[model samples]
Target chain A: MANFLVWVVWLGAAFACLVSALAVVSFRNPFYSALALIGNLASLAVLFLLLSGEFVAAGQVLVYGGAVMVMFLFVIAYLGDKSEESPWSGGPSWQIVGAVLAGGAILAEVIVVVGLKAGDFLSSPKPVTRDFGSPAALGRLFLTDHLLAFEVTSIVLLVAAVGGVVLGAHARQGEDPTEVHART
Target chain B: MRGPDIQWYVILSAILFSVGALGVMLRRSPLIILLSVEIMLNAANLLLIAFSRLHGREDGQIFAISVMAVAASEVVVGLGMIVAMGRRHVDLDVDKLRTLRG
Candidate 1:
């Protein structure tokens, strides 16, 4: 019974992904495309839950489906009433090639993942950690075991944030703050 | 009824992941392409979770959560750049954006 449900969830998630992919291409509206992708993302979270990675599932819901999708929608909202239907045309051939190559890669990945006999890893409902989902064990490792790398990543994000501000900033002919700042 | 194991979940994740990859390649819109990448990242998270469940390791979920954070950061910066590019040149053809492509 449980296995059947797992299959049902897995198949549902896969179907959602497939449909969303088609929508990404077929949709005339970019907003609709992003919306469809959210469906795909939500299904992934469900898949995570079924796999017993509750933390990951939560992250998927909070981060991907929630925050990221909102960001995309925000971008779209900012573009509201722009009255431009931005026709997307550059190369259909490239899309076809990409589809083929991507399809092949997925097929290969499926073979590898499925061929790895799952019986090797029993499903015992064992805690993922000594204290599953405990904030302490996870917290210590994030700040300690991976401390240096984590700090480095923070620096990288800082740089990226600054770069975003610089790159996205637009000034009028006689009102360039960046230029004034540079002069200073 | 035997529950589907990690392998099934992984395989399913891979299938969804491929769909995302296809979305990335096929879409002309940079926004859609970015969304596709996000989808791919989600698929990877699922894969990590599957492995964790199979191997009896909660650390896998932890790792996936961190990865999702990194992915979030990446999307913000990347979309900011893409949006900037779009603003400068109404056309967001990535192929055209490649001035550095020798």
Candidate 2:
């Protein structure tokens, strides 16, 4: 019974993900694309929950859906939301042909790679532990096995923060601050 | 409800990644390209978590967390660049930003 519910929820989440992802690539207005991607991210979080990745799901929601989406929205709103339809939408035939060929090639490669020996991974020999993807388990790995990488990630985040502020300041230095808002 | 086959997740991840790659290649807006990259990153992270569950190990999930952190930083830096670009009144068509077109 529980498995049935998981299946149903997974189906709904996957459908939502597919629709929103398609919308992300197809929408002419970038604001719409940003909104669609947020929906996609939220659906992915649900899938993570289905996989028992509680910590990962929370992180996805907090980081991607909350922080990242907010930044995208901020940029869109500040930049003045205009419908800038992609040039690729009505370009010469060769452009579409090339893009389609390239995209198709990538899709074929991914399908081939993922399809190989895929069944073997699903049939696990033992049951996963209740705490397998719990915060405690992930934290243990973070501190012990993956300690170096874990700490390095923190350093990277710090550097990125400083870099962002510096970049923003540099941009602010040349332009009249009032003009930025006025244009919007 | 008998738990999904691991292959199903792999297929979904592959599809998402492919779509994201297409988005990045075809989109003109820098912001949209960044969004595409985020989609690609999430696809990879989902695959990692799925494989972790399949293999009964915490390694993949830990790596996913690391990926999340990297993603957060990436968006910060990318958006900073976008904000900078906006200040210059550079038309958001990224193809025009080429200074070394040799």
Candidate 3:
């Protein structure tokens, strides 16, 4: 029964992930695409939980679903309706065909590789310690084994924050911000 | 109880990545392109966590966390550029923004 329950949840989350991913790409409106991305991220968090990644799963929800997505929503809203894209208006027909063909080719190639070469090794789950994915374990690894990466990530975030503010200020100074808002 | 096979997760991630790639290729909107990039990143994150499970290690999760931070920063800067373009009344179409074309 326990095994059956795990399979059920896995199937559901996988299906949700696929559906929301499609919705994210196919939605004509950027706002709807953003909303679909939130769903995709949430379903992915569920998948992370099933993979025994407790800390990663929680971070997925808190960071991607909450903070990052909210920022996307704000930008979409701020941009107003001008952000909407007419379906395949600017690009030529050949570009669309090429894109679909390339996407299908990538999907087929990955499936073949995973199916043939790595199938056996990846078919079973490895045994894990009781505290395998606990926040404490992750924190220890972050501070010790991956200390430089962790610190570097913080510096990158700071630089990005400063860059965003500088660009925003420059944009505002280029024109009357009120004029843009009024036009929108 | 055993869970579903790791291959299943990997295949799912691949599909998600392909869909994201298609989105980036087919869409003209910068916002949608950014959103598709997020999808691609999340797809990669899914694979990382799955492999982390397969190897019984925490290293992949650490990498996934780093990817998340980088993704957030990318989005912030990209959106700022988009806003700047909007203020200039530049058309949001990516194909027309080719001022650097030789």
Candidate 4:
């Protein structure tokens, strides 16, 4: 019964993930797309939980679904509807055809490689420790085996934060900073 | 009691990645493009965690965390550029932004 429950949850989350991902692409409004992305991220977090990645699942919800998506929504609202793109207007018809073909080709290749060629090898899940994906285990790895990468990621985040402030500052070449601020 | 096969997870990840690629190609809006990129990154994270489970290790989870950090930073910068461009009254269409085209 537990196994059956797992299968059902897995199927539901997987379907939700795919559908919302498509919704993210197909939605005409950027705000709707951002909302769809949040759904997609949430479903992915469910999948993460099923995989026993408790900490990762929580992080996915907190970071992607919460923080990053709010930023996207804010930007979309700030830009307003003026920047909206008509689905069929901008590019030539061939771009859509090419994109669909390319996507199909990629999907086919992966299905062939992972589903057919390596099927037997990946058919089973290995046994895991009781704390395999717990926060403590991940923290130890972050501090030990992956310390350099962890430190580097922090530096990268700092740089990106600085860059965002610099680029987002309202002052342009000739515009007075105070005036720009006042205008907004 | 075991869950679904690891192969199924991999296939699902692949499908999501392909859909994301399609979005990036077909959409003209940079915001959607960035969102699609996030989808692709999440697909990769899914695969990493699946493999981590298959191997009974924490390494994949750690890597996924790093990926999240990187993705967060990327969004910060990308959105900043988009806002900057919008403020300048520049065209938001990616195709027409050819000033850097050489």
DockQ of each: 0.46, 0.56, 0.65, 0.63
Candidate 3 chain A least-lDDT 10 residues: A175-184
Q: What is the lDDT of residue A143 in candidate 1?
A: 87
Highest DockQ, which number? 3
Q: What is the interface RMSD of candidate 1, in Å?
A: 4.6
- Looking at model 2 chain B, report the run of 10 residues with the lowest lDDT sum: B93-102
Give the per-residue lDDT of model 2 (tens digit) for B1-102.
156777778788888888888888777788888888888998999899888887778899998988989998999999888887786676777765554355
Best of the two (1, 3) by TM-score? 3
Q: Write the per-residue lDDT of candidate 2 for residues A46-154, one digit (tens) a residue.
A: 9998888899999999988888898888888888744255646544567557767787887788788767765665555246877878989888888999999999999
The lDDT per prediction is 0.67, 0.82, 0.89, 0.90
Which DockQ-derived CAPRI band holds candidate 3? medium
Per residue, candidate 4 scores C-alpha lDDT tens digits across A1-184 of 8889999999999999999999988888888989999999999999999899999999999999999999999999999975688765668789989999999999999999886756556876777778889999999999999999899999999999999989988755886433443423
Candidate 4 docking band: medium
Q: Which consecutive 10 residues in model 1 chain B have the weakest lDDT in total?
A: B93-102
Q: Which candidate number has the best lDDT?
A: 4
Model 1 lDDT tens row, B1-102: 145655666676676677677767766667767777877877777777677676666667777877777777777887787666555444555544444544
Error of 4 at A2 (Å): 1.0
Q: A53, model 2: CA deviation in Å?
A: 0.2
TM-score of chain A of each: 0.67, 0.82, 0.89, 0.90
Per-residue lDDT tens digits for candidate 3, residues B1-102, read 276888888899999999999999999999999999999999999999999999998999999999999999999999999987887777797877765555
What is the alpha-carbon lDDT of model 3 when measured against the actual structure? 0.89
Off by over 4 Å in 4: A173-184
